[model samples]
Target: MSIAETASPSLAEADRFRATLRNHPAGVVVITASVEGRPVGLTATSFTSVSLAPPLVSFYIAESSTTWPALRRAGEFGVQLLTEEQSDLADRFSRRGEDRFAAPTAWSRGPSQVPLLDGASAHLVCSRFDTRLIGDHWLVVGEVTRTLVLDDPRPPLVYHRGAFGGVSALR
Candidate 1:
């Protein structure tokens, strides 16, 4: 049967799906942008590279996100890949009703005035390429305009089983 014709999953099934996916690991990043001349950002594990030929990336933001209203207005944004050491920073941005760019948080403005988080393993400054409503979230696509790489040797952060962690070389 077609997806639209299928019955919606029960709440228990949905919870099971969420629990099952918790075993899968995902890289962490902070998506930032400036709106009304002020910095705004949020932690995201949905960030992923979509293409290499044209240097594109994509992430999903919930439609109910409080930060989405301001973030949607920006023509450009910054994506900072977090290191394992920045789990607190990740936790900070993921929270609600707080000044995410306060004194303790280090950051600077970059091209197009996008807010760039300091001490990240890498940063990607991107121009909004496309955005569309998909289910309950917006799928945002960006074209990379600039990239900054740090010399830090720390492993990139990842989230799995509802906890932040670093990876070890398999080989």
Candidate 2:
């Protein structure tokens, strides 16, 4: 049988798969972009590095995401590596039908007019490299054009078991 034929569509299997991923910790990030002179952003835990030689990074956005339509049109975007203190910020961007860029968001425009969140541990400005539909989400790859590391020393925020947390460094 083909790979698709072997896939289980049962809700139990889906729950099991989600539970497995929940046990694995993931770094949290806010993906930001500007479209038609407006800033849009969302929280994501699926952001990851794809390459090093040419500096490529990637993140997956759901196909049903309301923000995807606008983000898909942008030529450039920003990725902010959140600190442990920015869990509220993460929650803010994750919600739907709310003004994510409203006051108290504390962000500014970066190169290519991408929205850059303030107080993040690091910021990466990227130009859109490739995008393709994969399963129920869109796989977006970007080429890093600029990187900014904050001088502040703080633990990075992480997501695990449906909550936000910080990690301790092992020396």
Best candidate (score: TM-score)? 2
1-171 in candidate 1: lDDT tens per residue? 866546445656889989999999999999999999999999999999999989999999999999999999999999999999999999999999989999799999988898988899999999999999999999999999999999754799999999999999999
The alpha-carbon RMSD values of the candidates against the true structure, listed in the order shown, are 3.9, 3.7
lDDT of 1: 0.94
Collision pairs in model 2: none
The best candidate by lDDT is 2
Clash list (residue pairs), candidate 1:
none
Give one digit per residue, the lDDT tens place, for model 2 in 52-128: 98999999999999999999999999999999999999999999999999988999999989999999999999999
Q: What are the TM-scores, per candidate, against the unseen true structure?
A: 0.93, 0.94
